[model samples]
Target chain A: MNAEDRADHFIGRLDAAAAAVEQKLDALLAPSTLKGEIERPARLLEAIRYATLGGGKRLRPFLVIESAALFGLSGEGPLRAGCALEMVHCYSLVHDDLPAMDDDDLRRGRPTAHKAFDEATAILAGDALLTYAFDVLADPATHPDAAVRANLVLALARAAGLGGMVGGQALDLAAESAQKPLNQQEILTLQAMKTGALLRFAVDAGAILGAADQRQAATLTRYGAALGAAFQVADDILDAEGDAAALGKRAGKDAERGKATLVGLLGLEAAKARRDALVEEAIAALEETGLGDATATLAEAARFVALRNS
Target chain B: MNAEDRADHFIGRLDAAAAAVEQKLDALLAPSTLKGEIERPARLLEAIRYATLGGGKRLRPFLVIESAALFGLSGEGPLRAGCALEMVHCYSLVHDDLPAMDDDDLRRGRPTAHKAFDEATAILAGDALLTYAFDVLADPATHPDAAVRANLVLALARAAGLGGMVGGQALDLAAESAQKPLNQQEILTLQAMKTGALLRFAVDAGAILGAADQRQAATLTRYGAALGAAFQVADDILDAEGDAAALGKRAGKDAERGKATLVGLLGLEAAKARRDALVEEAIAALEETGLGDATATLAEAARFVALRNS
Candidate 1:
């Protein structure tokens, strides 16, 4: 394919993965009761569906699907596991948008889950979704191998839990009223936990699902880390310079809240330079995997992360 | 043994189990980072510890230990699993006490997690604890058998997710603003999801950890359902008639909020009667397990649930 056609192909693949995940999430979030349980509360399920199902770039699931495809395992297992990862992402968004957390009223051009529903429903929905992600991963259908499923649960819980995403958010909250701006290392650690951990998990999970060897897995880890950092820096750049209408949420709030970010520390031009170097680093790691052309899409993903406007 | 002596032994066993689990939670909540992660924030860890370390009856862990003992497995595995179950219980308390939920100012006679810390920390602490519960359960140390660990994750998630405790809370929240009092079936379903699910899981998880055969597992399920239901009915009875000083929460709020309960539907005497019958049913199920006196402590637990003052 030529350059333009290749770009279209990558976008098409990304969109297709998002749609697949959307369908999986819809089915997973249905009001039907599973075994060992009684009944699904309708409003809670509705809020969960609203928080997920139709928004965002679906970048996380796309990464999972593409990463799994690297090991020649383009099957239902990857898609199912990808949906589980996406559920965690959606749960975080729902909880973060609550009045107690980031307290935003808009997400992806729609009223936030709390605004559309009540705060109680939003909290319950977030809890249910997070729990269900583990449920899906542990189920026999996610993977026939019990060890793989168990490991996925362990890995995901860490990525989403203490010393990771939750800890990151706490650090960010504390940074808001701190006596001094965060040092670069502290900011990196916080960002890695808050956002980078989940993004890295997307690719790392694909490796687990594909049963990649230790060597292969480590290669993907490097790629995931670099890509995740690049994505966060790009996101910070957008928040700093992008418009609220294009961003679909409040923009320029990072500075307003006194939140420490790369853009604030490095200045826009240097941060842009950092993002470009990280993208190169990601692609280099992928090339080292020796999957060669099989990693073409992931290379594109690295570039895409650095370039996304919203 | 004399009756009093037997009671003393059971009480000691329960307290011992609680102490063991408390120690485990203390270690788990320490500000230490695990592999594949970054720093653990101090405030979040403190809030998690505060919510979990010193608290109400560790009844759930007691059930797990006692139930696992039925299969002659009295080891670290069951205790660790029990701690995981307790984490889930503590997380629910932290979230439920939030201003958006029960709006409680205190828990276990101290300021609620949200009150002691800010709402954001409490929310993150709850999320971290909940996520950490699954992390603990999925660890290789939780069980030698991957299938067992996977099954535990599946069971715990269902017990705690949409058709379980979270779902039940949502139902209760809706019922508070509901147009009318719920009917008997509605009230039963709501209560089952809200509280009975986790209580039931506390024993059912023991069965999973012990690798109980189908028939033995069914017997334990019967015991768990009866015990869990009896516990909840007793709780409702307390809310209706017990003092706030005794309950450590606002008394009679269920009636004030117009929340549906068996006590509201069937009256206090009838609810008490229901509680007693459930205890009988639980004891009978224990008797049927064919493990004979191995189930005696569980039988005692059923009675304790029905009779506790707080």
Candidate 2:
């Protein structure tokens, strides 16, 4: 199929995967009237539901489902795992938009968690979503094999923990007080940790679910890394040129916040070139996995990450 | 031994366990230079270390260690598992003391996390600690059996997650704006979810580590529930009578904040009575376990929960 056709096909699959994940999330977090309750508090649940369901690209889940399908393993395991990843992703957004963090009032064209609920409820919602992610992964229903569940938990913990997303956030906070701008390498390191880490986990998680060998996992991991970089570069590009209305978040805020970006360092054309190169690298790594034509949609996903306007 | 002597013995053991856990936390969280870094960021690490490491009674860890000792399965597993629980406990405190939450400046006789570090760092540190807890629990080093690690992860997630600690916090927040003071039953359910959940998990985790049969697990769970209730009731007693110098936190704040507590529902004398009854109930549950002398320390712990000052 042509590139445009392939991208359309990937978008269709992404929509389907996102819908499935939303269903899983709803069932997992449905409002409950437990025994002996005059009323169950609904604010936290509302905040969590607002922060999650019915928005965003669901790209990470798509990566997970597609990557798992490469090994002919497509079922509850990958879908639930993907939902867990999405939960983490959603939780990060909730916390990141807090008044003390990014102070974002809008997310996905709606009021952010702290805006929709309150600061305390938003914090609790983020904490709840994060904690719930692990519970979902560790449940026997996610995968009957305890070992696989354990591996997923470990991998996710590492990706989301001190040396990964949280640590990166610390660095980002430190940058505000930094005496000097971060150099190119520092920017790359920061972005890799802040954003790339979870995306990498998205694809790598599929390998774990499919029980891929070390070499196979490594190949997919490289693809994930490259795709992650491409996605970030595209994000930078979008931040520079996209409209806030379309992006569903404030655009150009990164530059306004004095945050470092590759696009700022390399200029628009160079950043675009870098994105395309990374997408090529991602496709090449997928080819190395020997999944052949099965990787077409995944390949298109990498291309879409580099080229998407919003 | 006499009851006083038995309580003293448990205290001594708790001191030793706390020391061991301190060492483990130090090693796990020591600031490190990752790949391609001249210096690691210190603020986040410092906040996490400060929030944990040196304060509190280590009561949950004590529970895990003492409860695991019943089966003579004292090893890295229980210690690490206990530390994981402690991390979750610590993270909860860090977030709970945020300006948006309880707004306490003091915790364990020092400045709270948000007070010591800025709000963003405190939030990230808590997130890091929470994320790190799962990493510790899921590691092979925690338990050779992946199934055991997975179970630990699952249990910790449940206790600390949406339906547990975070959910409880949300309920507590709603109570402030609540038109009516929480009734006795509402207060009981809130306290059970907020404080009792993790404490219950602490003891239940020991059963999992011990590979207890269903009957044995249920007995221990009952013990945990009673012990958890006793601890919260005793905490209410302390809040009413204990000085800040002794409690290491503001005393009488619950009443000042219009927060619901068992002490508020029942008068001081009745709250004390309830504590004693729960401790006795805890001891009875332990007796039913048929572990005999192995439960001596556990029984003493229940009394300590009821009677300890600060």
lDDT (CA) per prediction: 0.88, 0.88
Candidate 1: segments with Cα more than 4 A from true spot: A33-39, B33-37
TM-score of each: 0.97, 0.98
**Candidate 2 chain A: minimum summed lDDT over ten consecutive residues — where?**
A32-41
Q: Could you give the CAPRI-style class of model 2?
A: medium
Candidate 1 lDDT over A1-310, as tens digits, reads 8767877888999999888888877887776634444556778888888998888788998998999999877767888888888889988998898888889999999999999999989888889889999999999988899999999999899889886788888898888868999999998898888999998899988999899999989999999999989999999999999988889988999989888999999899999999999999999999899888999999999988899889
Candidate 2 local lDDT, B164-228, one digit each (tens): 77777888888887999999888888888899999999998898888888898899999999999
Best by DockQ: 1
- Candidate 2, residues A12-79, lDDT tens digits: the string is 98889888888877777777522222344577788888888988888898898898898888989899
Which clashing pairs does model 2 show? Answer: none
Grade the docking of candidate 1: medium
Error of 2 at A285 (Å): 0.4
Best by lDDT: 1
In model 2, the Cα lDDT at residue A152 comes to 96
